[model samples]
Target: MATAKQPVTAPTVISVDDFLAGNPDERRRADAGRLRAIMGELTGEPAVMWGPSIVGFGSYHYTYESGRSGDAPLVGFSPRKQNLVLYLTGGGLEERDDALLARLGPHRAGQGCIYLRRLDDVDESVLRQLIERTVQVHRGVDGGSGR
Candidate 1:
């Protein structure tokens, strides 16, 4: 199972520029740039900085059973200090049967997240499929719509 490396505690909020600025390593900056490209290609939407750290694409609103409702990005990603957090608001991998997800490098799938230590560790094809599927989900192209 893939797990996130140690994350910066308190999760320092970061603007896009600040995030890039903090990465002294050119590789990190390149990784982020690659991710942005993939997100745009997969989602067919322009990426938006949802908050300080999260780069999101698309949008939707949801209401919980508790009557709590909020707006969230349809698909998004975050470059945490320790790892990359792929926000799959659409859903998560089920078991190890899914071809696309299985191809993704070792990863731990939660209901709404896919954690990765590095971009090089993941299979580009699989990652692209996941992102494409997720974008469709967010757009209600599949049976289930956004929550």
Candidate 2:
């Protein structure tokens, strides 16, 4: 018999305030607060402590071709020592609008995350749009395959 595997990162009962307060620098803490507000308003979900470090908003379940499955945040961010890393949907960044990325200010996009050194570096409206897209993708509201 096979056992049901659990995801390595899952939501915890940790207080969102407490987790956010742990930011190592003042800038990160402030940026985290701004993100909490933006993501909260966009997702209509309160921030939750996902795993030990991520301040996540909503969640979605996913399965791969290998049959491995787990739940993940619809949108989230982690204020690391060096960068504010955003965990967008697994559908990846290719689906994002090219013009938007071009106007997103100085930042780097990963397979499913966007990294920025400072929130002040980007256009807030564009960031919000990217986040809104992630929420839409995870909720299956967007007509894409949500790959």
Candidate 3:
């Protein structure tokens, strides 16, 4: 029974439309659309702005050891200027998932975010499975996987 974390920032600037509108790169704009479509198909929940920059989908709350609690997307993707960011519950591309990562194409991980050059670089099928498995793991541990 874990309590959900509250958002640190308000959901003011958290729209995919606004994010794409502000991005001048046409490629990034297109990437955003693709991410939106994929995320929609995966979560069946519409995306929402997590902070001023992140476009999040469903949500789950977590409290860290420091007693800091915050709400994060159940699963979501973002098209950054340099890469496409995929957030998951795993501890950032765990070594055990190397086989899975190999299928994802060229990418790196940090904390809990998976960074990619673009959607096309990675197979969406692998991405979808990764996301689903990650959600299941998080829900199993956090007691609120949002599946």
Candidate 4:
């Protein structure tokens, strides 16, 4: 008999309000709240507490070459002590991404994520476009299989 595999992360019952109040201070809560609203609208998915910290919207199943697979949020954000992190796959669309980031103001990009110290530092409209593109590409709206 084989045992069932367990996922490392899954949605939790924690509400966005509680999570924000519990985790970050009042200052960070404002920022996280802003992201939650933005992501919720853009993904057209209700907010759910992912794992313990990440407030996620939408979900997609991912399979690796090694056969490992799991579901992850389509787009999410987490407020950290150092920086608020934006979870984005980028959908391998670099040319468009490069152009957007250039005008996105100051930020740091990492694998499938963007870190920002403050939301006020970036252009709101540009950020919206970037997120919209990421969702589109990941959802196959860009004419490829869902990433």
Which candidate number has the best TM-score? 2
Looking at model 1, residue 38 earns an lDDT score of: 89
Question: Which scores greater on TM-score, model 2 or model 3?
Answer: 2
Ranking by lDDT: 2, 4, 3, 1
- Candidate lDDT scores, in order, read 0.70, 0.86, 0.72, 0.81
**Residues 1-147 of candidate 1: C-alpha lDDT, one tens digit per residue:** 999554222223345566655776676677777888888877777767776678777676667667766667777887776777888753334542267677788877777688887889898988887877776666778755445
For lDDT, candidate 2 versus 4, the one ahead is 2
lDDT of 2 at 20: 82
| Residue ranges of candidate 3 with Cα displaced over 4 Å | 1-10, 90-92, 141-147
lDDT of 4 by residue, 35-116 (tens): 8889989999998888888888888887776787788888888998888999887445444478888898899886668888
Where in model 1 is the C-alpha error above 4 Å? 1-18, 90-98
Structural similarity to truth (TM-score) of each candidate: 0.76, 0.92, 0.80, 0.88
Which is superior by lDDT, 3 or 4? 4
lDDT of 3 by residue, 43-132 (tens): 777878877777777776667767666667877766788987888764535564567878888888866788988777788888887777
Question: Candidate 4 has what TM-score?
Answer: 0.88
Candidate 4 residue spans exceeding 4 A from truth: 90-96, 144-147
Best by the lDDT measure = 2
